[model samples]
Target chain A: SQQGEEDPQALSIQEGENATMNCSYKTSINNLQWYRQNSGRGLVHLILIRSNEREKHSGRLRVTLDTSKKSSSLLITASRAADTASYFCATGGQKLVFGQGTRLTINP
Target chain B: SAVISQKPSRDICQRGTSLTIQCQVDSQVTMMFWYRQQPGQSLTLIATANQGSEATYESGFVIDKFPISRPNLTFSTLTVSNMSPEDSSIYLCSVEINVRQYFGPGTRLTVL
Candidate 1:
């Protein structure tokens, strides 16, 4: 069974707009990480938020973790056409369990 | 961050045949893992490949079907045996460094 579940399976927005994706998990995790996958390519690590930490930021990416709620969210600020991709949230433990990704399309 | 690479980015194979995919990391990593992503689905762990040890298979996965080899810290290989149409998926290899896992460009396999 999958540990993480992401909502709003797909989203579309214009360049410069902000995009957000949410994920919920079933088990306790040491950390939660977000990844981006371009079409036909592998996953690229985005940001990681530890259980003890509530928020993290990296360039245009912002991630928030709520261990109490067993949920996490990824927010991409000032989205670009190049930002079009599938985003996944994974719960980290002895092994990382991935969620069904959310596909984001940023139109120019 | 680790730069991981996989060979034969994509391939088409016939049923009953096998295909071997190779993963090489730019730096040595202690834990390497293989995952399968069926079309329109999330990634599913196939096994954990550790250097100098037999690979650990996940539920519903067995060595005879998906054999893995981790001869050293920098490299590993996964072989899909007796391929079937249902075996078509993207196979990815990832290496764990600290708490983050980096993935290689996946091998897209099509079993006919």
Candidate 2:
């Protein structure tokens, strides 16, 4: 069974608009990580936040983790057409279990 | 973070045959993993490859169908045996150092 479940399975936004995706997990986790995958491609690690951390930022990406709610969100600010891809959230244990993912399309 | 690489980015194989996918990491990593992503599905962990030890297979996955080899800390291979049309999927290799993981470009296999 998958530990993480992401909401709004798909999204469409204009270039330079912000896109937000949410994920919820069922169990406790030491860390939560986000990844991006192009169509029929491998995953690229985006960011990871520890259980103790509430928020993290990397360039145009901002991730917030609320362990109390067992949820996390990834926000892409000032999105670009290049940012169009599938985004997944993975909860880590012995292995990482990924969510179904959110497909984001950036209209130019 | 690590730079991971996989060979034979994509291939088409006949049913009942087998294909071996290789993964190499620039730096030694304690834990490596193989994952399968069927078309239109999320990634699923197949096994955890540990250097100098037997690989740990996940539920719904077995060693007979997906044999793995982690000869060293920096290298590993996953062989999809007795390939079937159902085996067509993307196989990815990942290395974990501490809490961070880096993935190799996947091997896209199509079993005809």
**Per-residue lDDT of A27-96 in model 1, one digit per residue for the tens?**
8888889999999579999988889999999999999988889999999999999999999999855477
**Worst 10-residue stretch by lDDT in candidate 2 chain A?**
A91-100
**Per-residue lDDT of A35-79 in model 2, one digit per residue for the tens?**
999986889989999999999999999999999999999999999
Look at candidate 1 and tell me the lDDT of residue B41. 88
In candidate 2, what are the lDDT values of residues B1-112, reduced to their tens digit? 6888998899999999999999999998878999999998899999999999999999999999999999998999999999999999999999777677788999999999
lDDT at A71, model 1: 95
TM-score of 2: 0.97
- Per-candidate TM vs. native? 0.97, 0.97
lDDT of 1 by residue, B2-110 (tens): 9999997999999999999999999988889999999988888999999999999999999999999999999999999999999999999998887899999999999
- Can you list the residue pairs that collide in candidate 1? none
Which candidate wins on DockQ? 2
Candidate 2 structure lDDT: 0.93
lDDT of model 2 at residue B10?
A: 97
